[model samples]
Target chain A: MDHNKRYEICFSKEKDLGEFLKEAKGLNYSSFVFFEINDVLDIGEIETDFRVFKGIEIHKKDIGDIKSDISTYRSKVDYLAVKARDNRVKEVLSKDKRVDCLVDCFGRRNDFDYVVAENCKRNDVAIEFNFGKLLRCSGYERSMLVRKFHRSLKLVRKYGSPLILTMKPSTVFDLRGFREFFSLIKSIGFSKEDLIYSNNYFKRLIERNCEFDKDEFVEPGIEKV
Target chain B: MRFRKPSLEDKKRYIGFYIESEERLGRKEVLNELWSTGLSFLGEAEMAETGFWVHDCFDDQLIVEVRDGYVDEILAVVSLVNEIKNERVRLDLLGVAGTIRKLKKSFILNQEK
Candidate 1:
């Protein structure tokens, strides 16, 4: 993990892709990951120094359907995020190596707990702290979400699990720099060290995916000897 | 009048921030939202304790001066001010310094990159 550089993962609408890249670079993000919300997939030719990545985010769906979607999309993209609304889905995704991130832990207090945290840690599925969702709410709802965040971070830290942070920015305005992101979440018990680990874990994820994509690679332990 | 010793003087910090938004933002609108956000997040007691103040906002950058020990608290509040006048905005911490002059010279003007 180059501590000097930071990375962000955000969601983008089709029209905002160009400006999103510009804002991300201006904010000093070394890398930007995008999960297109719509059919705006013309992302091939953006002239910029920053490394851009494309990903898939699966929202709340039936367990069997979600599993099929995961299998279908997992190998195709370097990043796969599953929104596990059901505990069964969460359990399945927690142990699934194909899924890079398990999200939608916004169900007040029922979503994430110690068991999920431990399983995610043991199986290497990262639990995500989606910041853009937090930015969209206000008043009581926002405060309630922050309280849930406080609780969730406590459980995540207690289990020593891998944590990842993403903005899910729909527009350019939703993106934020590293320090500000750190400070805002720190109030809810996230530490600077945790932030570094999250960012570095993400960095490693990209590298590992790149290696996994090469023709010579078979799986984690063995290459095509 | 016996001045408080330099060592005993209240140490301060100036936090430089860049506001990222689609439209232009003015100091008045930004400051108003900041105060409200800080007040709501920290409440009146902590807000008073930190003694937060905005030095200036220009060219989409702003400097917030807070007590040395309270920098993080003020930062949290500033980060929470995600909107100003119905416009979505993001506040990114550019840098923080012991003096406003250094913060301005290094961060606002951004001589070093």
Candidate 2:
């Protein structure tokens, strides 16, 4: 899959949003996933104006497990899911049809159109795996997490919903080319076909949401995957 | 800029340093000499009231209101110390969790530690 096809940008600070919007305007990708922290609500204010802003993702890292002290982590994942739904409900109730999709960063809690399932079960949303984080853990841990992750992918296939593969890269060095991405996916026991499906699904979502013209969408060249 | 492992007795002193960086290192050195101990960092909380500027080093350099002009380096150092202290607290939590898990297993086995 082409690196350009799986483009995603995450913004934590408000200033980065403007920079991202300006940069994304010049890109030829069909869809762009923008993950924003809840504190920076101003980005949402300018959402409609940004032509390339396909979907808005808000991450609430609250997975209420007693083992981890994730308390300080803003927006619990489940709470964020509900909040996104509520926002969607309110938008629809107001008769505003601009917002097409609301994606929950982690797994789904109530009702969400898309979910990013990392080492967890899948529902209506898409499953995204951080291959780097998985590989960083011990081999045993990696295998265990992969088993759970693969199960989630299977659910996505059965449900016939879209799936997206993301690196969740915080820095530029984390970016990978097509070959590296394919090899990493293969190492995690995912088939070539699964990788292709994820790439296509992600592209379609971007195309639909971004409203990119046919000429604007760049077709990613497939490698061995 | 530099970190050293505090002695067992100095743990408490270091904890004080973690909380209050106002004291000079001489005070810490004197405490280490008297008690032969060090302090452990518990954790850090963001100074919500402080205004900060991004420094060239990519660390948040806080603006500490002093007598006249603001001291940027001092605020940055204090913030870093607080961060280290907070990390220590997180480690302490992880340690507690591990201990609890072990105790639970031991209890199930009808064993006393």
- Which of the numbered candidates is closest to the native, going by highest DockQ? 1
* Superposed model 2: Cα runs more than 4 Å off: A1-5, A9-32, A39-55, A60-124, A211-225, B1-113
lDDT of prediction 2: 0.34
Predicted complexes: DockQ each = 0.61, 0.01
Interface RMSD of each: 1.7, 17.6
Give the count of colliding residue pairs in each prediction.
Answer: 0, 17
Best by TM-score: 1
DockQ of 1: 0.61
Interface RMSD of 1: 1.7
Residue A197 CA displacement from its true place in model 2, Å: 2.1
Candidate 2 chain A minimal-lDDT segment of 10 residues: A74-83
Summarize candidate 1's per-residue lDDT along A1-225 as a digit string, tens digits.
467567777766647576567656756578877775312234677877788877888875687877887777766676778877677778878888888888886575456877788988988889888876666777788788778778888888889888887676677667666667777778767788888888889999988987888898987988986
Kindly provide the TM-score of model 2 when superposed on the true structure, using C-alpha atoms.
0.37
List model 2 lDDT by residue over A114-153, tens digit each.
2222112222234355554542343456455566566655
